[model samples]
Target: MIYVEGGSFDMGYQRGRDGADNDDVKNAKPLHKVTLHSFYIGKFQVTQEQYYAVMDKDSNSHFKGDRLPVETISWEEAKVFIERINQKTGKKFRLPTEAE
Candidate 1:
């Protein structure tokens, strides 16, 4: 895990920029600031092996490899996995929010 010292930063794009016609950018108008609290995040993505160790079941990832990142899981499944792993390890773990 890596410790991230949190701070505030400007988020979203400015109103005028070349090639900003896309809807995604349009929705991001009116620059805003976001503040975040310090937190720890995994240095690497969750691997199949780690998921298997925690969940006690095959992840059924499209590409089969112990070191590869786990995929094809829904948000609910990930929450359940985190809950179970927290129970096993006595550590609080959760998914990061979009701003995070």
Candidate 2:
């Protein structure tokens, strides 16, 4: 049950091309910034062990153990898992939309 504290962060390419012209989506970007408060996050990606523990069934994830981050999940399904985690821990669990 590792928890990750959240914070505001910038999300964008570290460098823009020298000739990056205007109207380019590269520049068409809005504030690629995400502002969220402190919340718990998985120290590792959701794992088969944890998923089975919470959902009472294996995702049949190929990772084979708790050490691997369970991937191949849809965005909506991930949200559902997060919601369940929040209920169990009494703290919010979510994904990051930015880079620190």
Candidate 3:
């Protein structure tokens, strides 16, 4: 895990010809500032092998490599895996929120 120093920043971009082209960027809206608190985050995306170690199940990725990020898991499965890992490590482990 990496420790992130907290700070405040504007969350959205200005709307104009010079702004982001994608419509999805509009979801950021109102150009408001947000404050964050110090928190720990994974240094890298979780790997297939790491997921397998925690969950004791194959990641089932077609790529099939230890270094590759695990993908295509349902939310419920991920929650269960996180719970199991928390139990084993005796520490809280959770997915990052969008604002983080």
Top of the candidates by TM-score: 1
User: Which regions of candidate 2 fall more than 4 Å away from where they truly are?
Assistant: 1-40, 98-100
Instruction: Report lDDT (CA) for all predictions.
Output: 0.88, 0.64, 0.84
Per-residue lDDT tens digits for candidate 2, residues 1-100, read 4555666766544345334554444654444677666655445566777876776776766657676777766778678787887899898656665452
lDDT of 1 by residue, 1-100 (tens): 9999999988778756435568778666467899999999999989999999989998889999999999888899899999998999898999998788
- Compare the candidates by lDDT and give the number of the best one: 1
TM-score of each: 0.85, 0.57, 0.80
Count of steric clashes across candidates, in order:
0, 1, 0
RMSD of each: 1.9, 4.6, 2.3
Better of 1 and 2 by TM-score: 1
State candidate 1's TM-score. Answer: 0.85
Candidate 3 yields a Cα-based lDDT of: 0.84
lDDT of 1: 0.88
> Candidate 1 vs candidate 2: which has greater lDDT?
1
Per-residue lDDT of model 3, residues 2-99, tens digit only = 99999998776667733666777756566779899999999998899999999889878777799898887888888888899999999999977778
Misplaced by over 4 Å in model 1 are 26-29
Model 1: which ten-residue window has the lowest total lDDT?
Answer: 15-24
